[model samples]
Target: MKRKRVVCGFGLGLLLLGTGYVSAQSPNIVIIYADDLGYGEVKALNPERCKLETPAIDSLARDGMVFTDGHSSSAVCTPSRYSMLTGRYSWRSKLQKGVLNPWGENLLNPERITMPELVRTKGYLTAAIGKWHLGWDWQKRDGSYVFDEPVRGGPVDHGYDYYFGPDVPDFPPFAWIENDRLTAMPTENSKPDPRGGRGGPLVPGWDPEAMLSTMAGKAADYFDERASDKNPFFLYFGLTSPHTPIVPSKAWQGKSGMGAYCDFVLETDHTVGQVLQALEKSGLDQNTLVFFSSDNGCSSGPSKSIKLAKELGHYTSGKLRGHKGSNFEGGTRVPFIVRWPGVVPAGSVCDQMVCQIDYMATVADVLGIEMPASAGVDSISFLPLLKEPQAAPPRETLILHNYYGEFALRDGPYKLILAPGNGQGFGGGPSDAEAIQRGDPMVQLYNLGDDVAETTNLANIHPERVQLMTEKLVSSVARGRTTPGKPLRNDAEIDLYKKHLHKGK
Candidate 1:
């Protein structure tokens, strides 16, 4: 296919030189974020190995640009969401460990310049449609439960004009919220959900199976509402499926022969199709810049069913090692596809190492807005890669954080994991005896270009390289931001080296 470098059509105006300014209106932006969807799960990315079929997602790759080496900022949800929206690493903040609990305190600091706020500055209408798991300040009903007092310090406070979704489907009040208040107050207690983790403040007859479809329907409705509006829209549609509460709706029950997990993934794809179809019906597809990606790699399947999934020929992580919460590619690597008719070339593959944190700068570049020194400090725009597939990535050094918030730095193909431990927690990687027998070192290092699976550790083989990367990681942490500008103070002390060394002891 012939590639196009020109950025025109879809109402994008004149690109002024030097000064970040656009003469005309910007395009509509829609980001479809998947929860726990793996790089291998999408058939187009892993054609030879992927077992489950993801036609809707695959179509996005076929019709747009597919990033072969895209990643989330962290291995888990809250941090990933934080970095993606704020364009700064979550480790720079106080959340260095596991995700937030339901109705937990907001992770987004009040002063941060979020992605939505940047887009809104370009005269766009911003809306967060699903899974606002980054945390919220809720009014408590005494000390044990939460009341429906408008959720303060949430998406609305951060940047979004509207917000709707379950706070965290996996760990939740078992209800949906629109803007700040619950769509319907919880009138009954929810039994332990069969899908996965479940908790109280449940609405009467709330069905986990209906959540995805409901969110999809709401998004479609929103599209309909905006069909006639002249202003551009930015929809951050966060899908909460293929994560836990693995309830594949009745329509998708027996779709994927692999298992319930596969079925849920198919349903997730179906929801994507619904949103795309809505855009098409609204005549918005021609001008919309749609991005499809996952929060992180797949987690261990329900009740350790990942082994069963492998037996059924479905490798969720593809050739990558470890699952979510590890320091391996399978933990942070995720599928990223961008579809913008006319502008982004169809069926192009870019192998640059792009991080979700870069979304802020990418949008800023698209809108021709200058990002302040304090904002998006870690973001490096991959916007050039969108126009030219062979363009060099804006970033060279990429950081990966494990579930425990341990750090790893990747420079070129070589990656240096700062501390000793297997990628997966709970001693999940090869047994220590096996690793010792294979001569794995205290700190792990691998050339991901040659060893995508991360099986071989070369820490002891190249001491100088390890020392250099370790120093870089340490400097990045202390500097407060990775991109240029004077260093800022971190919210709290970040000592990932200590955390990784003492973890799983």
Candidate 2:
């Protein structure tokens, strides 16, 4: 694809000068967030272990910088998405545990400034397309949806100018939503899913396999429509693939010999290719800053297990310890790739600690905007690292959480889990009791520099480190913000040692 320069608008030029960073123009930002994609699933990230081929993702990595150490805020979807948009850890919100239930209230506080809202200050058009699991304020009465009314507190209400896609692929109201209303009211109850998805009102003849294709087509259309627009745009292209209802389209059925899961992964790669191709076709690829990452790690849904993929010599979590809902490395650690033509070094790799919460600050820094003190309180801009790959790490510490409110703090290479065991809600290793029975320590610690797999526990060996991290974790929660500013109050009083105390550890 040939590079095309976008002339900087006068307003953007002034903004650039104000922030002391000069650029030709503000680049179009596209975040391609995948659901339940593991760290090693990308062939380029784990060539020796990952069995499946992901040409589109691999090509993306080759065209940009790949971060070997990247993570989501949580090991679950809803919380991760929440943190990604707001730049605040989800634990600070009322939802300190698992995901929001179907027809649940919006997770984002209306007062909060989201990624889209932050970027729009500089006149950027924003659209959020596909799989908004963060939650919605559905109009409901008498224990059912009021389909005629527009959903409130959705993507549009927060920051996006437009929104589309099924709210949750495996959950309720199986139909298409455009903006804040369903394109077609779901008048029929969905058939019992063979893959064990929740039964809910669905559009007539709703085909689960077609969701990804539809999302990709809509995204392509969006790029085409906005190609001639003067303003730079931001698109949050969330994918529902490889998460649930493991229904690969007929064309991709057997493309991967590694069965349904692998096939779905390939289909996901194809969708990514479609989006990139669309960008290229629109001649916007050159000026677009593209990000590719997952909400969490690989999960074993009703369709197939990560174990089956492992049986075929494809380690979804790479060499990490646990899967989707765990606090272990496998759960939150994910494949992160950033591609910004002419700016970021191509085919380069940066092994620095970064979290999804940094998106807000990073975008702010890129656009030369100072973030509000109240918003993106946990975000630390990695813009320096993006400009210079070997720059010192933007953040020295990171906090990780799982579905069950389990906490893990990472300072430098050493990680300290507040509780024993993996703290996984699905297919995890020993439970707290099991770990106790197995003579495990009260807390778990590992030096990731020497043991990325988290094979041996070092809590006993590093008592001072454990105590220091524990205090830091508690202080972080108490302070309610990681980055320096006025100490904010948490929405709820968080008990960091709840799990440990419950298990008498």
Candidate 3:
């Protein structure tokens, strides 16, 4: 049955009413988006692992709702973040494959209304801090390493009142940016090496082993000082530790027996703790909602897991087949934990399937804000689950887009992959049509509820379902563009990505 649409969203009120919430105040929201951490990386989600003790994250799940079936909109970084903020599908734009480079041109358009903008309208201060994978316009020309134009169309432009960090690297332009201006200029600065390795082009800066910790500390300070009667703020504190280059700070070095990758994650968890602490310190605990999730599954190269398994006896994506850059379960399904002090139940777990794309609508639903018709076209609000532990949200299908532009639509237990190849390409170019043709990209169907690892193929067993899924996948393509917030046509840049893709890690 279609849920009755109310003129005024009584959703949040009804949700609070379940617990007899009589307060007139709304909870402050904080979304902690982590880069490249997998579901198994969180100890609370994957308890069998002992090396990566995410005490901060474990406490997060212990105090909130741990959603088992949460997913990024795409199986990659840029697109997923785009969808999460815009509440729309990444395919709504044109550049569907891979992600943006550190110095790439601006991806989001000026007219886009972001989550921060939405919440700020209701009197909340907003900021975005961390790894900005979404494209920002930086000055680069004809193979020039130095920059010309200051980067544009980033967090500040997209509704974040204050922004820190870069479109890429920590190193020349390595200095942080407060809003559109530079926080500190990089002059007479040591030419830091490209920070990310394994999966990287290695931009400069990679300096100050204390970068991650400092960001966390400052963010905690920001929350503590700014979150008061004068400023109820929303902070999108994105962390970049576990992404690549495998640089764990000295304190965390060799801390996790699993390897440098796991150690980096420990710091990531610690950073999450700092944000929560900021809330608690400000006495905003009971009136705040904190969300923790990743851009996608771990951005591990195929060899990293094998090496870790041989040396430390560990698998990054747990038992899920395939890893980052592929259209497999491990590439997308990630850890999602939500904690709203006094509102969300502690020690609870939800297995309902939800995508990061739904974030905008859920927040809007929670705050009694309505989304503009053009935004979040693919979003379904899961606000109901926050109030009632067992109350179910609408059963909605989720679509996962791969670098190759091959698509998969997941409905309930059944998933249909619309491609011509094996859908797993190691080249990082994209599991595109050519790769699929070369690899027998046959249509695949799997019941993920029963086969969470996506090991068995049930396509042949259910031909009718395969046909239905194929139709849906085709429709998604027909309706697809690029991310909605992106510019109309950046053929010059999109083509550049397409040309350089074959040379990727």
Candidate that scores best on lDDT: 2
Colliding residue pairs in candidate 2: none
Task: Please provide, for model 2 over 255-370, each residue's C-alpha lDDT reduced to its tens digit, 9 standing for 90 to 100.
Answer: 99878778999999999999999999999998898989999988856425556655677788888888788889988999898998877777878788999899888888888888
* lDDT, candidate 1, 1-505, per-residue tens: 2333333332254465353334344678999999988888888887767777788888898889888789998888889999999999998888877788766888888988999998887778889988888887876566756655677887889899998888788776788888888888787876677778676768887878988889888888888877767778899999998889889988898888767888988999999999898889888888788999998888875624367455766678888887777778888889988888776778778888898888888888878888888999999888878877777768889998887667889898899886666533531465333444555576889999999988778888999999999888888888989988999999998886753244332
Local distance difference test values of all predictions, in order: 0.81, 0.85, 0.68
Q: Estimate each model's TM-score.
A: 0.93, 0.95, 0.84
Of candidate 3, the 10-residue stretch with the lowest lDDT total is: 1-10
Q: lDDT per residue, candidate 3, 1-505, as tens digits?
A: 0111112222343345332232367667788888888877777776664346788888888877888788888888888888899876776665667787546666776677778888887788888887777766665577654333455677888888877764444323565666776654444434334444323232244454666886787687777677544467788888876776567789888787666677788888887887778778878777777888998877667227657756765666776766666677877888898887666767777778888888887887777776676566677778767666456644457888776656778978888766543234641323545544455335667898889777667877888988887666555444433223333322222221123323212
Q: What is the clash tally of candidate 1?
A: 0
Q: Give, for candidate 2, the lowest lDDT window spanning 10 residues.
A: 1-10
Between candidates 1 and 2, name the one with more favorable lDDT: 2
Cα displacement (angstroms), candidate 3, residue 47, comes to 1.1
